[model samples]
Structure formats: C-alpha cells, structure tokens
Target: MDNDEPLEPETQDEPETEPAPQNSDETLYCEAEASVAVDKDKAARESSETDLEIEDTEKFFTTGQRELYLEACKLMGVVPVSYFLRNMEESYMNLNHHGLGPNGTKAIAIALVNVSNNDLGLEGARIISEFLQRNISSLWNLQLSGNNFRDESAELLCQALSSNYQIKTLDLSHNQFSDKGGEYVGQMLALNIGLQSLDLSWNHFHVPGAVALCNGLRVNTTLQKLDLSMNGFGNEGATALGEVLRLNNSLVYLDISCNDITNDGVSKISKGLEVNESLKVLKLFLNPMSMDGAVSLILSIKRNPKSKMEEIDISNVLVSEQFLKILDGVCAIHPQLDVMYKSVQGFSAKKALLQWTNPMKLIQGYADQHKITVLDFFKSLNPKGVMTMPVGDFRKAMIQQDKVPVNLHQVRELIRKLDDKTGMVNFSLLKTVKP
Candidate 1:
C-alpha cells in the first residue's frame, strides 16, 4: 500500500466496455440524446401553448366596436381564450351585439351565408339593407333587430322581399320603424309567400302598421307564427288582426302580448276564433283584458268544438274571482287545454321540478321496475285497499324508500287538483292529468 492513496483492488485484464445500442440501429451516446432533445422540443411547444393562454389574457377584450354599439358594446372586449376557441355562432353573436361599421356588417353577412347562423345583426343601418339586397336569397333567417331602420332600409327590405324566396324568418324587432316601415313590411308580407315567422315587436309601428300587416296577411297563406308584441297595437290594430285571423287559415301561433289591446280588441279576436280552426296557441298576457274580454274568449272557445287551441296564456291579466270561476268552468269543460293562470316568476315550478332531482323520473323508474302504475305502487304500501292514504305516510314511504324528492306541499296541491271531490289524492283521477 502507498502512503498517498488507498490500495486499489487489483483485477484481471478486461476489454473496455462498449456503449450499448438503445435500439437495433441507434447508439446510446449520440442518437438517443437526439431523440430525447426532439421529445423535449415537443414538450416545449405544448408548454408554450399553455403560456400563450396566460399571456393572451393580459391584453384581452380590445373594445374595438364600442362607439358603434353605444353602451351595449362596452363589454365587447376580445377575451383571448374564448375568442380563439369560439365557433361561428358565438362569433356571430359577439359581432352582432357590438358596434360594427358598414364594411364589418357586410363581412359578417357574407360569412353567415356559409355558416349555420343565417341570422345576422348588423346594427349598421344601410349596410344591413345592402346585405339583405345582396344575400336575401341565400339566407333562411335574418335578424336585423335593434337597427335604426327607417323608410330607406324598409324600401330595401321590400325590394329584397319582392324577388327573394329563400328567406323564411325575419326579425325586425327593437327598431324605430313607424307606419312607413310597417307599410313596406305589409308589401313584403303580401308578396313573399315563403315568409313563415315575422317578429315586429318593440317598435313604434302602431295601429296603422298593424292594419297594413293584416292587409298583407289576407292574401298570405304560408305565414305560420307572428309576433307583434310591444308595438302599441291598440283596439284598432287588434280588430284588424282579429279580422285577418278569421281569414288567415295557415297562421298557427300568435303573440299579441303587451300591445295595449283592450276588451273590444279581444272581443274581435274572440269572434274570429269562433270561425278560425288552425290557430293553436294564443298569448294574451300583460294586457288589461278585464274579465269580460277573457270571458268572451272563453265562451267562444267553449262554443267552437273545432277550435284547435290547446293552450291560452292569460297570466298577469286583471282578473277577478269571477274570472277564475269562469276559467275553472272552462277547464272543467276542456281539461286537456292548458290555461296559464299565474305569471312565471324568476323561476318556473315545472322546470325546477324536472331539473333539480328528477323525482318524476324516479317514480317513473319505480313504476317501470314493478311493472305497475305509480298508483299501484302506493296501493302496495297500504294494508287495506282504501281509495286514499294519509299524506304523512305517503310522503314518508316515497322519500325514505323510493327516494322521490317532490315538494310535499305541491304534492298535496296536485292531489287536490287531481281529485276535486276528495282532499286526498285518488289515483283514479290520474286519467284527468294533462301534460
């Protein structure tokens, strides 16, 4: 042993170890490191993609069209993540709400011809008219809502409607179109047989406009649904539309809610409905059609067995106890027809009941599993075959074993609604249940 270093183990002579090949042809020393570098580069690219998401958010939402859309476009900043990832419809909606110039509107209109979103909202006035003039034949639906459309744009629309046949749905709501615009719309309605749905809501088109539109409807048969809500259609307008309804055989759904129409107006509609057979759904909310007008409509419905109306919306109307009594009488006659009595608040009772826990689904599953009706399932729980059970036991059995989470109070009310003769739920009355 030497003093300077520890003694090393003396071994037999061996050949220098060779670098092993990682693959059949690849060497560990150089080529393997190269493959690792390539993998690292690919990983770097993915990391940069994530970094791009972070960096893009810093300057997102460029308020490009703020001035044009007024305050409505204030929030129309380009959110970096959604902007790049959003589909055509999202892009169109974002483009629609914000302010856009003529060139921009034209671009969007041209783009819409190829996309599923046939609706374009060009707040740009003349640009929208020009787009309609050019692409009206290509579009199936055009929504020019909230545009400052006066007679000039109306003339353009009328010209488009005269020759165009492809466009079916047009929404010109939330504009300042007076009688002049309405007259042009009437001309369009008279000429365009392809138009099915028209929404002229929330505008200044009053009784004259309504009359002009009705004049067009006299000859038009293809129109199915019409929304003239919030256009201040007084008694005169309502009367005109009522007369048209009598003749317009193809029209199915009519929404004249919040149009300030009165009993005299609805009286005309009632008379028209007596002769009408195609109209199925009628919306008459937010109007002060005191009990008399509603009664008139109800009486007309009762008289006409051929009346196809399955639903009537009388929510928010000024009704007395007499009105409800009359409605109950009407319902007693036609339990299949749905009469919406109360206004839907911030939420819908039916919608919530369906969404939250799906107790109806649970009951349906139980009924299917047992191969019996829900009524039969309840009968199984009772020892004696009585027509009814205590509400407490019924609720407990459902909640504890079957796990149905329907509202107890609503259940009680539903029992009463189903069986007017008994305070408890009688399953035989299930035949009266309507969807």
Candidate 2:
C-alpha cells in the first residue's frame, strides 16, 4: 500500500457488539410481575383515598349542621341554650313563650326551625322568607303561630314557598295578617305541591280573601287539614268553599267554625257535601247557623253515596225535635258518622204547651203587673239601653218570677220566636207586637 493509505491500515479494534440479549422467559416473567405489582399498589392507594373522601364528606355535613346552630346563636346575641346545644341533632324543638322577639326569631328562622309563640314579628318573617328563597335548608314543618307577621311578610313567605318544594306544614295563626296576606297565601297554595296542613285561624280573612283562598284550594290536591276559623269569612266565603269541596278531593279536615257563617252559607256548603267524597271532619261549631242549616248539611252528607264524613261538629248550634228525628234517620244509614250538638231550640216538656199557649199575653200580664209599658219593661231588662240583649240574658229575665213570671219552657219558646238569628233579642220588635 502507498504510505498514505498504509496509515489507515492501523485501525483500532471496534468493540464487538454482544448479540442483542436473548429474550429469556424468566426475565419476561419478572418484568410482567413488576408491572402488575405497580398497578396493584396504585389501586390500593386510590381505594384508600376514596375512603378518606367519604369520611371527609360525612364530617362536612355534620360540621355544616353545627355551623347553622352556631350562626343562629351568634345572630341572636346569646349563648346557645343548653338543651338545644346538647341535642343539636334532634328534629323537634319546643321553645314556645321564649320571648324571642324579632331579632332572636330571625336568628332561629335562619336555622329553618321552630320557636312558636316567640313574638316573631314581620322582621323575623322577612328573614325566614330570605332563607326559604335560597332553598338551602331542608326544613319540612314550620310553626309561626302567634307571630306578628303582617301582609308584607306573608307575601314574602308566599313568594318563597311558591317555588319551594320542601315545607309540608305551616301555622300562621294568631297573627295580624289580613286579606292582603290571605291573597298571597292563596297564591302560594295554588303553586305549592308540598304543603299539607295549614292553620290560618284567628286571622282577618274576609270575603274576598276567603274566596281567593278557596279558589286556590279548588285546584290544589295536596292540602289535608285547613283551619279557617275565627276569620271574617261570611256566606260568600262559605259559598266559595262549597265550590272547592265540589272539586277538591284532598281536603280531609276543614275547620270553618267561628267564621260568621249563616243559614245561606250552610245551604251552599250543603250542596258541596252532597257531592264531596273525601271530607272526614267538618267543624261548623261556634257559628250563627241554626238547626235548619245543620240539618240540611247532615242531610246532604247522607245523600252522597261516596261520602266519607266521620264527624260533623255543630255543638254550639241549637237543635230541634225535627232535627233530632232527621239525624236519627241519617245515623241509621251511616252509623259510622258522629254528630255533636249542645241543646235543643224548642220546648219539649209536656207542660210547655199548656202553660205558654199565648206568650205575648204572659208578657203583657207581666208588664201590666209591673205598671210599665211593654217597651219600658224591656228597657228595664236591658240596663244599658242598647235596644238589644243576648237571647240567653232575655231568657234569664223571663224566667225570674219578679221579672216576667214565665216558666223555663215558656221562656225558651218566647226567645225562639223572638230571636233575630244573631242570638240577640231586639227591643224594637216588641213595639210591633200588640201585647
């Protein structure tokens, strides 16, 4: 080779590449086992993490509930009551008559709980409405009875409840709310699907409000118990409720007592009872309705083939012999029904017919013996000169030997003939009688 080419011949030894490592079964097995071991470790770690997450979630909910109580106590500006603090998880709480005014009541409402008779004024109701609208809490039963909630508070609460699907029972009795509040409540009832029991007694729901409420009930199928007692709902209200009874099938207990309903109203309601099939208890006590109205109502119930009426309370309404007879006939057919009444309106004693053949003559004799005009005699009986007195009071005077010299049976008959259906005896009517 030439000298330049010969220099290239002194080549360094290239390290021989070892044959690529031959795949061994044992090595492949070791690698596969290592991969499986890694996967198992990862899975164990993930499972432990999931368990920890579950534990954390439980702790979070518990802490949240306690936080609600703590927040309420803070807003109330008082230490947590020991009973509530000790039983933080208890569902029922009775803090009635606690003197928790607006601020304290607001605090309690934020917790979405009960503290009835706590003087929760309109401000407290506002707070309750705010939380209800937020839809965070899961409160079901709400008792705000004896709270001083007004129309605005009622509107706010109704607005919240219109969309909420949680609350089941609500008590708004003994409040100052009136027709405006009642209208709002009616609107709420029209939209609400969860409420079942509502107590609106001792409010000022009159004809318009009552009609609106009943109209709402006509469409509602959830409410079971409704207390409209001690309101100003008159015959118009009764008529509206009668229409509701004709259509609604969910109402089971209806307390319309002490609502100034009269014979016309009862007659209207009787028409509904003729068709209704779900009403179990109808409370008509403490009303101005008479035996005729009560009798008509009972008869209507009897006429219904699908009536589920269990009890009809007309305890304060005066009954008659005819009413008792009709009731006996109805009870014979529906022995499961119970009718409650207090007294009979007419005289049933044997001597009553013989003694009081002419009640006007007996009264005229009493006035002549007293040497006073008939009007003057009534004026004497009525000390206040109001020209009217309770039938019971007039009956008491009639039975006094020195006053009217009439027997009990005779006095009852006289009052029955003279009663104005308002349980009042008008003195002006005596002027028309030629006794």
lDDT of 2 at 203: 89
Candidate 1 — which residues are off by over 4 angstroms? 1-106, 113-137, 318-322, 332-335, 343-370, 373-435
Residues 237-309 of candidate 2: C-alpha lDDT, one tens digit per residue: 9999999999999998899999999999999999999999899889999999888898898899789978878
Give candidate 1's whole-model lDDT. 0.59
lDDT of each: 0.59, 0.71
lDDT of 1 at 113: 34
Residue 310's lDDT in candidate 1: 55
Model 1, range 175-232, lDDT digits (tens) per residue? Answer: 6788887888888888887888888888787888878978988788888888888878
- Clash number for each model: 2, 0
Q: Which candidate achieves the best lDDT against the true structure?
A: 2
Clashing pairs in 1: 61-77, 61-78
Q: Tell me the RMSD of model 2 versus the true structure.
A: 28.1
